[model samples]
Target: MASSSSPPEEQYGTESTDNYETTCWGCGLRVMLPSGASIFKCGWCGAITNQNKKKREQKCFGWRVLRDRCFLSSVIIFMLFVIFGGVWAVYPIVFSISLLWGIFHSIITTILSIATVSFFSLAAFRCAGTPPNILWGSYPTVGQGDLENYTFCLYCSKPKSPRAHHCRSCGKCILDMDHHCPFIGNCVGAANHYSFVCFLISAVLSTIYVSIMSVYASLHIWPSLSYSLGRLKGMTGRDLAWRLMNEILIAFLRSTLFLSSRGLLLAYLFIASVSLQIGLSVLLWQQLSFIYQGKTYLSNLSSHADNEEEKKDCQNLVRFFGFQHPVSRFFSNFRVTQKRHDT
Candidate 1:
């Protein structure tokens, strides 16, 4: 039997009332109140709740700010890599090798790479700048019987729609939130999911093009590196070791000294391009998988399975991107639009 007159601690003696059961607002999981008795942090979704106020805090200022800055810096670094590694380094080396074909291919790849980067950068910026739609109060047309369809956000003190969630980083609730991406400095939601997807696809394509060009450049460098190693076969143990070390030193210098060896510049560009390609490819694959399954990264983390209504909602999202077919979605992702939805 539950005690009514006394506090929970008093009734239970040594047992603490701070361990009270509560529901996590973020992921709808059961969680225990913290030892302090004033806050409950959800381990699943990283949501922090005020036990006394029964609300989540709006802003997270400390590490989140630093993290956001780091992400922005990463974007800058990526741009630099594309400019220096792809344009200046690899393209020049290719041009020096075969003038006509190299110039033609380099120009085409560089233009395409630049266009993709520009489009995605614009999309990411636009998505980050856009604000989320928040429902403030009850609808006049919604009868009392339909109240269960809506949920209230304790933090925002507003009515939350079916797919909406509170973003601690953004300090508000986001409608149909996919995930909060620090890399883009925004929450991926219904308003920006299209842009986010477009950015991913563009990034993937750009990286792929760079990777192919990088491989071609790398093939030219392999002969030089192989020749250096092949010269040590007839040398004795001590002489072989000394020669090997000297060859490695020369190779390192050749790769690092930009003005001296084209091989080094090509090698550097190849590694960077291939690495970016692999990373972007994996990310694109994940995004595509989520789209095909009609789920966002956040929804997946919360174990939200799609029903008929959610499937319908997903169809609406696809249509919003001006895409009716999967094949067309890739090509038309960068088409800018002013369409906005309040729901």
Candidate 2:
């Protein structure tokens, strides 16, 4: 018999008669490791497990933030510079190249920045509009034996839950108001506000980052041509003509040079700008909606938080919104119930 402390056969690469083949940790299936590898990664079951793990992690954390679209745009801009392939090395051609590059980068960066910004905005709105837990302020199904002690909310004039809040901005009860944000440009209430703000914060940061990078790229690539009104002073006719020619060349280079289809790039940029603006616009719209409805992030999360003149009405509305909201049902398991809203 082998000693109890002997290393496993696999550790010593010993020959074993027993069946020993690489297997997936997720599924009890045998699979060969890739060549020159000691471990095998399960393609199917592993993927499922990993995804489940990720989702579980998301539950623990607020949410998984996506990579910045601005960063992607930055990569694209860099790629464009690469495409030019030192054609810009020629000073004579620098004029046209620089000009064209600026126009092109500006248009593309603007578009991408907008898109990146929008993604965040959309996320914020979705979070704010449809929060996680939905608790109908409707009386909980209390039975005779139910010894659950409940508290009343001053704001909504309803039973308070563990996680409810009062939104001062909206003058109503909120479930889980993180904070009011002017950047995503909205007040994040109980619903999807986390995701919404996560998206916005990520987006705002990305846009600001990309914008700064684009500016740097501009300065590095074509510093002077982006701004030039007229001919250079104290220059002969020949010199003026040369300078004009140089400017024209830089302009063209800055505008047209790219890694792929020029037309496509332009179109994408236009779309990006429009999309970002639309997202911000949506968030802004939500601000007024909540305001008129008279609610803030904290108040919106739970209806029971606020105890004002219209506390009952507010509770009813919260119950309706919490119950009918698409995300409310989904988040029920997470204990994101409307009971959190304190009156």
Candidate 3:
């Protein structure tokens, strides 16, 4: 990393005279230095200037303290829906299709469910993980004025690193910040971006798989219903309406009380699966768009040209999956990147 401290006497030369002035390490404001002054605070930005230490200790609220409990609760509820309505309810119906189909479906569903759970857990860990270090000065220095593309963080009392931004929610400066995601209850930055993307992908795939099974199960239910209603003879409009309503009510009661109706269970799963699938799809599209543009979510909000170095799609994949060989790059499309520090 480039040093952000005051220039050495060899570098500054005669410029290091008693009248020499430097820019504040926090906010770039020109401040005059008193002779023999070692430690001083920035009057403008309120950043304490100390030449010996590049980083200062600041109180940080880690994942547990900063997490949004409500969002976590919602995630748990959704997981339950997938497990009970989607997975458990569809198992028997899949087996009834054929022994071969049952075996195949079981393997696929189990794999997808495990993947979804793993990704979600990883994402949660990343979200609560420690963020990148704040950019602090090595030595006390006067402010010269703010540098281009850099700003001071009043909360961390440190110079914001290139591509870093202060997250009000995190109460700290984050490097390569994308956005604060309410779903994860944390900011998506260079560190955890890959985990977050994986979570979204797995959730979508799992929901879609469940949805297909639900549809198949639903098809099986209509035949049973038709057989039961076949006994009804030609009737008046009012009588037909009453009969259909009563049959639906009975089916619902039977399913709820005995858990015997594949149709009712499949119906519930289908609706929930479709709803979750749509939402996850939208989020996945947005994240992919950001990756394609070589920009973070925050950068996308502005029209300004991105100053950070851009990574190729394959390089991003390698970074995310920690691939060492060239062959692994071919699989980049299925993966996303994260900073090494995040791991």
Best-fitting candidate, scored by lDDT: 3
Best by TM-score: 3
Tell me the whole-model lDDT of each prediction, alpha carbons only: 0.62, 0.42, 0.65
- lDDT (tens digit, per residue) of candidate 1 on 286-323: 87677766777887777445433355346644665676
lDDT of 2 by residue, 1-343 (tens): 0100112332212244553445333233344332444323233222111112221111311111122333445644643542232223222233455878556655654555556455554643443432223232212322211212222344443443444544433344445565645444344555655355345444444444343443343443442435363657777788888887888787756654542343333334334534554675576455435544656544565567455343324444445334555455567844644556532
Tens-digit per-residue lDDT, 1-343, candidate 3: 1122334442321233464466556654455666566555554434545444444444455544446556866886778666766656777767776889889987887788777777766666564334344434433343333333344555666566557777766676777788877666677777777878888998898888888888887666544322258745786699988987888777755545543566667777888889989999998988887776577788877556555556547555554556666675545633544433355
For candidate 3, give the lDDT of residue 302: 59
Residue runs of model 3 more than 4 Å from their true location after superposition = 1-23, 26-67, 127-150, 223-262, 306-343
Model 2: how far residue 247 lies from native, Å:
28
Better-scoring candidate (TM-score), 1 or 3 = 3
Q: What is the TM-score of each candidate against the true structure?
A: 0.61, 0.29, 0.63
